[model samples]
Target: MKLKRLQKMSSFLHVVLKILSVSSVVIAIIVFFMKLFNSKNIIMNKLESDTIFYFQTEFFAIPDNQQYIQTEQWILVGVAIFTCILIAWLLWIASLIFKDLSTGFTPFSEIEINRLRKIAGLLLIYALAPQILYSVLHTILIPGYSFTFGLNMSFFFAIIFYCLTEIFRYGALLQKESDETL
Candidate 1:
């Protein structure tokens, strides 16, 4: 029956979400440490190679003076690694939300509503955080460079999540009213 199928699907999703949450945490930790330790060496090696071979690095242009470029690249690598870990953490939190939803947690519940709103706000931050980090980096690291700012598609997703939270609030109100009439 449909109910049985729904139960099976929910259980499946619950299991998957739990796995994803754990894996995301592990992966984020691994990536954070790996990048933290190796990024400097990696950047150094690439810069050395690029200087010797007269080639440009893909991530950024190698300006004249290897020492100054090395310092700038180090900062960039650190910021990029931090950004990667942040995104993974966000995904882990998202998995937590989906996990509860799959395990019969009501969307209209206060706890679920709060989680949804928190994610919505995080999504907005997610949209903006990297730009702010990069802008600051550019201002500090790259002299005579103009600052540029823009929002990506994640802002749209944040808006959608916010709307979903409001819809859930309305649903909860309606459910409470119906319960009162019973």
Candidate 2:
């Protein structure tokens, strides 16, 4: 009964994740084109407005003589699009895992273990890539910008998923031995 419920839930979540993955890719594409065309009316103006908000929130004071650099704005938009793509990729992997769970009779299997490892690798990349990209671009585009390093929740999740994959592999091996004995 519990396995049935889990399978049903996994099926539902698989559908949801698939939809979210596609939607994120679509959003990333739209953002890319908006940035590519240099849409002054929409994306550029929005970035200008967001710069004020960022300064106000971070520094608690808005600079009166702050100049808007189009190159910096472009870099920020590129990072945003890259982040969206990464999110979509992660969601697609998650959807595949859920699809496998929904269809397979046993969760502790070789395919599922491999899928979990892939997710863990992707999560590690997702955690670090945007920060690295931003620092590199800013160091090149903006004067006197030092490299920044940070870690977020995704880093921790990557470790957890990798551990889980190992555990699942062990379980699969144990199950196989038991079945052979029987």
Backbone clashes in candidate 1 total 0
TM-score of decoy 2: 0.79
TM-scores of the models, in the given order?
A: 0.69, 0.79
TM-score computed on alpha carbons, candidate 1: 0.69
* Residues 1-182 of candidate 1: C-alpha lDDT, one tens digit per residue: 86556656766765675566566567656655665678655542212221222222223334554556655565555555555556655565666666666666655777778777887888888766755675567556765342435546777788999999999989989988988999
lDDT for predicted candidate 1 compared with the true structure: 0.63
**What residue pairs clash in candidate 2, if any at all?**
none
Model 1: residues with Cα > 4 Å off, grouped in runs: 1-4, 36-65, 141-146
**How do the residues 88-142 of candidate 2 rate in per-residue lDDT, one tens digit apiece?**
9889988988998898657777877887888889888877786678668866766
